[model samples]
Target chain A: MFEAEVLSGGFSNPAQDSARAFRACLDAMARPGRIQQIAGAVPPAPLSPAAGAILLTLADATTPIFIAKSHDTEAVRRWIAFHCSAPVVAASDADFAIGTWDALQPVSQFAIGTAEYPDRSATLIVECEDISAPTATLSGPGIETTQTAYLPNLDAFVANSAQFPLGFDCYFTAGNQLSALPRSTKVEAL
Target chain B: MTDQAYNFAYLDEATKRMIRRALLKGLAIPGYQVPFASREMPMPYGWGTGGVQVTAACLTPEDTLKVIDQGADDTTNAVSIRKFFERTAQVQTSETTAEATVIQTRHRIPEVALTEGQILVYQVPIPEPLRFLEPRESETRRMHALEEYGLMHVKLYEDIARHGAIATSYAYPVKVEGRYVMDPSPIPKFDNPKLGGNAAIQLFGAGREQRIYALPPYTDVVSLDFEDHPFDPSKADHACDLCGSEVSYLDEVITDDKGSRIFVCSDTSYCTTRQDEGHTGRLSPEGEAA
Candidate 1:
């Protein structure tokens, strides 16, 4: 399923690009409410560059991922399966879930994780049409101060954070840009 | 050299840097299992992935490596791990504990006392002692950060209330540096006492769980116990029939169809060394009473 073409002029290996993107993810997640743009592969459509970058970075045979709606295309599935060997699971049982906000179903469908093992909660990568600086207000663990990003919906996220460590961590992916909002972050409604 | 195909120690320099940073934090606060984004190795989980990751981070080309499972260097998993290092890092491997600069183990601590320059790494399936009690990392991290250990004490206290002794015979929980209550892996309780004030640096890695923690030499690690019920590190009453050593942990082995069983030291290397040195028990051909 993987259209294996050795891309020229980029890092010699996909693993190198993966490492770089993964570092961006680590920095983005560790400091909640941060935006980091990553570019490398132009995955087939419905798989945004940002989301594709993330899949390349963190997903492997070790991680289980769930694809919802259009993101569940066979082509995309085959690509991921061939490259990462990451098992696909139901939304309720995934370590990571990918799709647009609607495709993922009710935001509450994913595992929020229990109190003692919040890290068990699934991280969602929501593909968006566009992302810009002039967005909603955000505050959380990674925020040096307060940061804001254009969110699909602010109230749902604010409600999500109220659960405290039990909420799913989210990454908003659009084009080649991505930003993270861990459960520790507190979103404010404008 | 075959090692040129991969980076030093099989892990790239970037991954090593990441693991090294986490190890430093883990060492700064002994016994605290720091959460690290553990990477997928060329090997599978439930094997020696955790120990492999830790060893990958710490190994230098000059270091002599040792790998053991159930305390024997010849065990299949031990041989596999030793071969991994040999292929990836090109480091010298040893079966003797004293000759090793770094030792990775599962389920047994070496009987030979480790010194200051040596490093011990443990393969952990689950690093959280309270994971079965509470299944949320978020809650547990908060619990640790706040120094809340009531749940652990209550669990142990209840165990005593039911059983005449603490029911957990192995993998006993320990409070390190008066802070985090860490799982000491699945070593028999007899080795629990060796966890504290040790001259060698100890590190633990749980791959699937994505956590790494450490114990610096001389760190204070106290086993949990109430004043009324002191911690008991007990082993089987019988000594090894081959080694004649009563001070080591023993694995119960059933030798025949009639259900006759013999107790042998769980630490195979230590037992073999003792037997090689002419130490023998009643069952040995060269035993004093034989």
Candidate 2:
């Protein structure tokens, strides 16, 4: 059923492309608010290049992915199965989740990890229409002083930052551009 | 084992992804030790297996890899690891501190200032700061959960009361971003100063402990100490006898049976760079006939 979808828009060079994509993701998280360009994967509709690249680079059998309703199309699910083999799990069970800001509502259902193993939390790959301009001031570990970037909702992010070592991280993607806002970053709307 | 049978960088994609995920989490919470499924590598448990695995995951076709063991690139661990990646990943390896995109270190961050985009991966034997004071894993986990670090402070205090100074030198505890008190591997206390506000992204990995922690560039890493007794980054009083370096951390070398000793820069790359620039110390090759 998914033979045709498997052959399209996947990394041409898995070794190099995934490596570069991962580097971009790493850069995005390590230095929050800094926009990094990522490419090398073109999934079915609704999945941007940056999001697809992230899924291809990070998702595997070990990681369970939750596709939100906006990105819950049959083509996207099949592509995820063919490319990464990550189980499509419930929101709470997801190690990673992908969707737009509105589709990923009631974010409390996702795992923020336990006090013991806080790193067990989910990482939401948020697909945005565009990633540019400074909407909020970001300051924390990765940032030297303070940086500003456009996030979907600042209040939600500020609340997430309060969780510290227990909150889920976010990767904001638009087209081939990407940025991240880990829980460690303190977000305040400008 | 056939080299061709191994995947890129020696680790299969799945394992790399697992490690990569752990790494992102580690970076997200600076200095917090994140548990990972540590794999058994071709090498033994103690000799930089964690750092190697981390480096393998972070490495790409475009990266220039560098490996150092106790500040020297020519050591056994460093040479073997560099060779391991060269054969497995076919990436270029360098001895210069500034040249490498990823530097896998077993103690001793390079003396030279690291720039942005460079990643420093440390081989950590013990990733937990409170492991010595409280041996039980469960209790330590509870202490961390409660943000209880009194035991570590008491340990440091006892050392000061006993020796008139913080007796601990290496593997010194540091609080990252005012949160987790982390063990910065076995790097000397003198090197601890470099841990804070450095441009390079610092990553710590312990294969035996199955833990990985990180310090993103410019992260605040405060060495644990009391208010009256501020943390002092101390080194050998003598300068590098070969390179005439005064600021760098020095390794003492016994020259003769008569108790003649000379201090040399622990960082081989830094020392070589200085020496190549015509800097000479008391025991430099052209300075004295030893």
The whole-model lDDT of each prediction reads 0.76, 0.91
Residues A51-157 of candidate 2 have per-residue lDDT tens digits of 99999999988899999999999899889998999999999999999999899987888899999889889999999988897789999888899998989998889
Summing lDDT over every window of 10 consecutive residues in candidate 2 chain B, give the lowest-scoring window.
B281-290
At residue A13, what lDDT does model 1 achieve?
49
| Best of the candidates, DockQ | 2
Over the stretch A75-154, how does candidate 1's per-residue lDDT look in tens digits?
Answer: 78877776667899988888789999888878888887664444456779999887675467775333445677777887
Q: TM-score for all predictions?
A: 0.61, 0.97
In model 2, which regions exceed 4 Å deviation? Answer: B288-290
Q: What are the candidates' individual DockQ scores?
A: 0.03, 0.86
The superposed Cα distance between candidate 1 and the true structure at residue A183, in angstroms, equals 28
